[model samples]
Target: MTPAQRRRAAEQAARRLARTSLFRRARHLALYLSHGSELDTGPLLRCCHAAGKAVYVPRVLDGQRLRFERLVEDMPMQRNRYGIREPALRGARRGAARMDLVLLPLSAFDTQGHRLGAGGGYYDRAFAARRSGGPRLVGYAYALQQAAALPAEPWDVRLDAVVTEKSLHVFRN
Candidate 1:
């Protein structure tokens, strides 16, 4: 899809997501900034800002760990090792367990909610401590990113749902 088409699709999906019970019930939301051709999260971020939800973005730490830092209007940002813009404050941190909902970024995913990320393992490491009752994990991506099947490793954390431009694919709870 062209850039304009992608933007439109992202906006449309954000609108759909804003109406979902998952999004509505979320008090602390974790989202990723768009990279490459991934679905742009700008629209979703805007919605979060307008709705008064506490939005957080990831910052990569040592040992492939990720810390969610609250996003504020005046907070300074910088590119990390992978060149992703993240909140510069390393002091104020929130663990994955504290998040109400997490909108994950993925390269590819399966119908069963197996995610193929950028191979960084940051997300896996961050949420490794989570039990079955942890925060809600949702993969956000374009519809074209869905795969028929993908191999899952023991450490691979499956998503609870995947919000695509077309629809929200919820996996078994």
Candidate 2:
């Protein structure tokens, strides 16, 4: 997709997310900044801020785990080893269990809620303890990223829903 197409699709997906009850009821949310051709979260971030929600972004810890840090206005940012931008200043952090919602980035996903991340288990490991209840794990991606099915492992964490530019797919409660 071209830059313009990406922007438009991101906006559309953000709107779909904003209409979800999960998002509306969420007071604390986690969102990842776009890296490479991933769907942009700038619009969603703005929407969360406008709605007075507390937003957090993932930060790599010890090169093996992820801890979310609150996103503050004008906070210093630095690229991670994977070239993903994260808050530079370490502030109060929260685990996935504490968030009301978490919008994850994915390379590909299936209707079964299985997601193929960037080959890293950061999100999976971060939210692994959450099986039935806790934060709503949602995948943020373009419609084209959806696949018929994807392989899953014992440690893979399923998403509650996935929001694409075309629509929203809820896999489970």
Pick by lDDT: which candidate is best?
2
Number of residue pairs clashing in candidate 1, backbone atoms closer than 3 angstroms, sequence gap of 3 or more or interchain: 0
Give the C-alpha lDDT of model 2: 0.92
C-alpha RMSD of each candidate structure in angstroms: 1.3, 1.0
Which runs in model 1 stand beyond 4 Å of their true positions? none
Q: Score each candidate by Cα lDDT.
A: 0.88, 0.92
Colliding pairs, model 1: none
In model 1, the Cα lDDT at residue 173 comes to 46
Question: How many residue pairs clash in each candidate at the backbone level?
Answer: 0, 0
Residue 89 error, candidate 1, Å: 3.4
Worst 10 residues of 2 by lDDT: 124-133
